[model samples]
Target: RDLNALGGLAKLMPFTAIFTLIAALSIAGTPPFNGFMSKWMIYQSTFLSGNGLLVFFGVMALFISAATLASFIKFYTTAFGGEPTKLTQNVKEVSSSMLIAKGFLASLCLLLGLIPALILPLLLSPGKALANVDLSGLITT
Candidate 1:
């Protein structure tokens, strides 16, 4: 369906709207999503670094994060609010394969957030080998 021509999110496509909402929440760094965990780690590391400039930038990041959430909320509400437009009146849900693909990605986001340790080691391996450093020793877990 041509979502660009749709008047409201409800009118566009249900499944697509739901998925978009989830993705938007993730991007906004809401809790229980991968984005939140990653952002939290970034802020934590920046604070622990003991660098004044980094701390300032971290604070700026927080502000930007808030702005991002607000902007996305506005966008979502505006796009999904109101009634259907002429072009979107006959819009239908996306195909099953597409939904399955999106679902997999969304679930992956949640899984990574819930158990980052599962993939952290693999992610660090390349960097560890390149630097000839045992980065695993730095992380207690």
Candidate 2:
């Protein structure tokens, strides 16, 4: 979905802000976003697995973050920002309605990011039914 919005694969470029956001969130162990908490569990599970090579996996996760940032910078500078050209001159700012929609979604993203507690309970209902574990009590929020 984000790929489609950013542009197709042919012209597609990475966005570091998005990747950094994912990495930071993943490392934080917060809930409701399905990022931080899951990665924390995975890190714990890997350590418990008793596989010494799991260290490499953890290292790779960090390395991938650097790569993600580099890719995002390349894409942002090359694809999005530049002096206007003929093809791009035709492009206009997205409509106010579209901006409003994006702004609402962005706020939702931030809200989920800042307060996972609100989302954790709502998600736990269905998640427990499927996973058969009481995750509701696990989240701080």
Candidate 3:
């Protein structure tokens, strides 16, 4: 999809930054964001599985986080770096509406990261529907 949007992966550095920012916001489990729900599922599942191997998943999450930061740095160092090339010099700041949209999504991402519990009921709906199970009793020890 990014390729389709930017003509190819060669022109994808900017998209990569936005993508990394989104991932970072998500891992934090803030509020009003999908990332919160996703991390919540990871936390809930890891605890419920009651297996030591599940603990390793937490480490994996951290590794993913480091990788996200690295990717974003790559995007910044290249896409917005010093000495803009001919092609990049023509680029201008995105429109206000586009920036506002991005900011709104970014804000939601932060919200989800901050208060995941606020969305627990909505997040758990899928688990409820799947097996007709009541997960209210499951607690991480």
Best by lDDT: 1
Q: Put the candidates in TM-score order, highest first.
A: 1, 3, 2
lDDT of 3 at 16: 43
Higher-TM-score candidate of 1 and 2: 1
Q: Which window of ten consecutive residues has the lowest lDDT sum in model 2?
A: 7-16
**Model 2 ranges off by over 4 Å:** 1-69, 139-141
Worst lDDT 10-window in candidate 3: 1-10
Model 1 scores worst on lDDT over the 10 consecutive residues at: 1-10
List model 1 lDDT by residue over 10-124, tens digit each: 6667777777777888898887777887677668767767999999888888888899899888777766767877765677778999988888888877788778788778867
User: Candidate 1 or 3, higher TM-score?
Assistant: 1
lDDT of 3 by residue, 44-130 (tens): 677557788986796686567567657655654454445545555455556667766777777667665566556666756787899
Off by over 4 Å in 1: 1-5, 130-141
lDDT of each residue in 1-141, candidate 2, tens digit only: 232234222222223334334444443443444455445445654555667798778766656655655765555544354454444445545566765665565556566656666566776689788988886654543
Against the reference, the lDDT scores of all candidates come to 0.76, 0.52, 0.57
